[model samples]
Target: MRWGRTPDSAVTERDDDGYADLRSYAAIGDGRTLALIARDGRVDWLPLPGTDGHPVFAALLDAADGGCVELAPVEPYTVRREYVGPTNVLASTFTTAGGSVRVTDSLNTGISGRLPWTELARRIEGLEGRVELRAAVRPGTCLGQASPWVHETAHGPVLRLADMTMAVRTLGAEDVVPGDRRIDVTYVSSPGSRQLLGLVGTQAEPLVLPPAEELDAGVDRTIARWTAWSEAFSWEGPWSDAVRRSALVLKLLLHAPSGAMVAAATTSLPESLRPREGVGGKTWDYRLAWVRDSAYALTALFRFGLREETHGAISWMLGSIRRHGPEPRVCYTLDGELPRGALEADVPGWRGIGPVVSGNPAGEQLQLGVYGDLFAIVALYVGDGNVLDAETGRMLAAVADLTCDRWQSRDSGMWELPETRHHTTSKLGCWVALTRAVELAEDGHIPGDPSRWRSEAERIRSWVEEHCWSEERGAYVWYPGTDRLDASILLHAISGFDRGERMSRTLDALREELGCGPHLYRYSGMAEEEGVFLPCSYWMVSALQLCGRTREARELMDALQDTPNDVGLLAEMLDPATGALVGNLPQALSHLALVNAAITVATTS
Candidate 1:
């Protein structure tokens, strides 16, 4: 059914099984973890401390079996909700015939912004007249498995298990509803009074109690802190408001203390439309950090003058690389452990999307572009006059040396597919890594084998020109043996590997093959299995800028940006025919590409 505050032109409908519209879930997190809060005042997805931690609540997977904490008017009422200020603290108003009540939801802030200890507090304030209130505290199915017991304690109700304990408090409400894996209660409040419902985690330890007054102050302090944090951003351009809102959302996704950024706040929101039957496997856990994503994320953070955050990400990446050792892993846990394999959840997936997956399989894949990504980031800082220490310089040289030797070998490429292929884009990535290596060496920022890097990068260039070029199509192919037009070639052009006639020819070829309306797909007429990639369109915009095709780049960017949701959140892909958002929602890579492409266009055009 149509509900909550959505864009004016948006449409909503209940599915056959009476599911709420999936789009109503707004997200809040402490950077290391995330929670999806629905319009009805229920939080569905919250991992306790780390992104890979067992979820405290997981209604995002199976609504009935998955647990949630809900607050609302006991009597029938209309609902309205919005974020309080620029913060993730959400205020939802319940209006009954007698009066109205506004309940605010927030994850408590640590003193002066320490992290890993999470507390979610809800407060209901009566307005105008007496309003009846209702609450249900139910938790089940953590880490894709259901919980064992639902207990009613002397103080309050508790959901206890091996790993999680959520003690909840309700004021002006009685536990009237019986237990059936769901906790329900109702009460009445008069005007000029208030009630609080607090959900705090003990992490299976004895509950530590913070007094009601302190908890309330904590909530207020949190609101103020986020307000102060948001003011640091200064935007002066078209779509500033939208841009600011997006930037704020992104900031909320960062783990404040650790400075590690998550790719998205929700997992398995689905990347396809085929799973209308609710089979439960489409959801992929995105809470963990990806090297590629962090690389791009740091760049965006730096662009906005959030240098501390960028440095934090840099530290995390470097530490993870060191821990993982000589071969850098593609993705890792927030705590820097390499994930084992994909986990299939037992719960029914969101909207019939089968197999809500936990832990990424891509972690095991061999993606060769990471070296290039790392080098590009480090070189950017060095070019800005930041000095690289001797160890960091040695690491950069080692990475470049690896690139020189391995760029010719077939790998998974940027997409991390199952098959290893001679990917043209990946070879170009090698070119970028080596080229930056040469730049750093020449600038005296690092002691690298510049001559070797230049010679090796030229060897890769010669290989691409000889084997990857398509005489029939007059543009570079996706792989050595394939004539398919892949959108990744746009990145090759934008990276300054081939910016002259070769780039112009590839640009025309990509436009002819990959362009769907104003946006460009990752490849031409790919099968359903591969999906339509949106980031490639962003790469196209950057390529256009690098090639002096400013008008096309601006036009394409404007058109592609319209695909994001009302909150200016972008998905992984968009269907060419129906314009439906496909792939994962709120993709960090897509947004990073957008921000960087905008910067490129502004500086160049």
Candidate 2:
């Protein structure tokens, strides 16, 4: 069942000026970090040591100064690539006029857990006639102003950039030359010939090259681990393959040691390819965990009966709140600490979009919706026959109390925009949190003032019904005084805030106003600002199902699944005009929404 590359016909290179479309890249991770491999046999983006660590390969953002690991045919060739079944291993087949060869790529992992060292394994197998394979490993200082050099070891050559050191090993290659910033090697492979190349990285430590057999075995072990994890998934619903693949992608973004799920594997990947004064300049890092995104991920995993990931996420959130306080920050690092302020890198952004940013300033923003997001995870966990500890119960009660105190104030909404207003979605998010808190207290799972929480929840609900609904728009507006539609309201339909004709009418209004084909913008006037918000599109699918439009829901699911990259990975957003993926890659929100929407379609249909 492994999706091995079998050469069927010749492939053609499709790149616009050497820059691959964002949709043309597939991802491979070892639960610690991830790398984006393009269709043309290039490792474009990789964060070494950790998911939130500095970049070693960042060609996805800056092709010139950013480093990359490339293995491709010297001549123009067609390519076909896919992941090995139920695993993150990628096999890409390159076919030229003379011959075809298949290259297998993986982030090697240990059998028990993540390996201490970062290893990237590329196995090239000759499939047809003779073909020349060119390979190179270039190291960079994560867009920082540091120089890289090459040093020779007894075994082979090593590339070093500042604190990071990479050991390069080659098998079945000839005419290898080690350069200052890159290592170049070449080999000719005919039928039945094979070659293996490995790059292992360690920061501020002496390099230890594992034996050749051990490195080879690492690939098998990593594949076996991923397969075992996938097999254990308890989903037997429609779109099962896609759903399981989404779940696996979500698992890849999880920082296993800390149980924090990152929003994406990358940062500062521009939301648009073209530069438009203010809009094209919008790019932010997503390597940290947002409470809202994590809550959605936990809910999705819980739906598939994945207790381990659910508990891990809950434990991480609770631990963070206990350490920092009951007030929620917009996002936290993988280690549960507040992220430092954003830093503007002096590197050309993706496709020359300037102002490549690291870290995120959104950490300081007052995102009021997070209260509901955090509690929603707790409610789902307890509802699934799990018990909360005494400390967690007290934490929940405190958060609910804070929500009651702050629901009347204005703050940044779910989109995290700067202009603060009375966001109707934020109000309802508190409503959801308080409502769930009351239910938990009533069920004796938590210690809380249920009567007070219920009263506050009802008060918020009444306020929303009174002021947020727009008679002219025939749906709930983003806030009062503006007839703008927001896709975030669709989440309430999933939350059971209102599943009656009112929500159905809102769905129709959102579709008519905010939707472009199967994709949806976050709010009014956003099409010119950014790409289509991907999670909002999936939210519509769930909303349609809630409204009894089962056929429409299934159709939307099929179309939305088609939007992923060739390897079944979704970015945070997509270009409605060109269907190109935009924003940070392998986004957790998009994947989680997809999983939930598929389950909704399955259960409703």
Candidate 3:
């Protein structure tokens, strides 16, 4: 993951055109929001105020018009960065011919927790001779969603865009001069010298510009808070480092105020590194929390002794579902609302891929697997000795009734494709739901007709075993009457389903058709569409281990989970062939899969 050193004075990457390789960026955040900082020292993608907000710094999505905050050396310099211990604070050393400088960046939080408003703090210290650094704050159109402007304010200067007021506080630099939706300054770095840069933003509220000294001090407090949370996590596995990092990534994606976990910190990062017709044009906004993702997060969080996240997720998820009543949307906003649907934004998109999208259509789709997601979380909570309120139990029983009535219908499966079908995984999801419901009923946790639930659960199992199982392919097809295989079926490996020699052979069939290098394409016929889906491949590890192939599972787990980028962060997918990270940065489901896979193998092995 090293940048190329140039023969000339400046050290730069092959992508000197402002766009960076997706793999070269690292994620830094508070629980409220996240920012992607590229190797060249650009804060490329940031959803302002909150994870679900509009991106105020969106250069990652539209390099030309997308806004960004730059805090890099004026000259070319090679850079390397790592998190400061377990904290999301980033420490990067930039070495230029004149000297080397270290930049520590963190989303400042109070000693108690997150701040009332958002503040991005950058602390600059000189480690060597002398160097010149340039700092700029450029607000973009938010992929044609908003217009940004600058104006004078009682607190020095402020930038305004789409209901957000932004102010920059500097400890050392030139005077704050506001340009066309831009602010810039230049400063010198001397040995043992220190400087601070803080960007404070508030949406639909008065921007609170904290003092430079206070912001600088808050970095330490933020680090301490992160350390406390990370230290509180418990893990005894050999892959503790990897698991801990994944947990931290999940925490970063967690919206602390709402107790909802976002899928990713970013949007519109393409699935395909190169724009292929079927692969590249598709870009999704994954900022909202999904029931499936939070359910997965719940398991990992509960396993690692992170009770706050688990409880928050459970409360938010169940409450949101209760609000939806008859059926839950595939996902929800940070504030528990449904998305309006995706629309192609005017921003040219990452590297001119075009049609950068906003909102997720899955929110409106009938992902039948959501029943399993809903029941699985509730069952986990109840199994952990927690009590479900009568209201929630009644709500869940109604959900179970709906699952029984609709499990036979064709609908968008876990993949959330436009084409509806009797996806094997979808039916299995219903089976899981009903089985868990029956358990809950028998345990006196939730109100349910155990007889009916168990009967329907068996019916779902029989239906899948009959129609979904492809005798010709010797594997469970993606849907009934198709040769296609879905990687999500691997979830069945650990879903308490009967896994026997038949399931073992299906695992092999999936590997043969979907495996590329150490990666597995998300489904049949997707090898050329995009990078291998990270979660699907990680799910393979669970499938393998549960199938009694611990050695193979461990080997694959070692290959996948142990090989993240320099910052130990992974995106939604990866071009295993080229080693380019594709899709969004530090995806929650991907990290959750890694954590759960390790937990699965550790407990089994």
- Candidate 3: residue 293 lDDT (0-100): 93
| Count of clashing residue pairs in every prediction | 14, 2, 0
Q: Which lDDT tens digits does candidate 3 get at residues 249-330?
A: 8889889988998998877788887667645656888888999998888888888877778889889988888787668779
Model 2 lDDT tens row, 1-605: 11212333333333454566777788999888999998888888887888888788888877877888989998778888888999999988888989989898989998668888898888888999989989988877688767789988777778888788888777788778898778998978889987888888898898878765567677888889989888877898888877888998999999988899999998888877675885665788999999888888877887777788888888998898788877878799999998888898888778777688888988898878888898888888888888999988887888889899989989989988989999999999999899999989999888856889999999999999999998788899999999998999999999889988888999999989888888899999887778889999999999999889998998888776677766788898888777778888999999999999988888777
Candidate 2: residue 279 Cα off by (Å) = 3.2
Q: lDDT (CA) for every model shown?
A: 0.71, 0.85, 0.84
Candidate 1 lowest-lDDT run of ten: 1-10
Question: What is the C-alpha local distance difference test score of candidate 2?
Answer: 0.85
lDDT for 323 in candidate 2 is: 84
Runs with alpha carbons beyond 4 Å of true place in candidate 2 = 1-17
lDDT of 1 by residue, 303-368 (tens): 677777777777787777777767777787776778778777776677666677777788888777
What clash count does candidate 2 reach?
2
Residue 308 of model 2, lDDT score: 82
Q: Estimate each model's TM-score.
A: 0.90, 0.96, 0.96
Q: Which stretches of candidate 3 lie over 4 Å from their true place?
A: 1-11, 14-17, 278-280
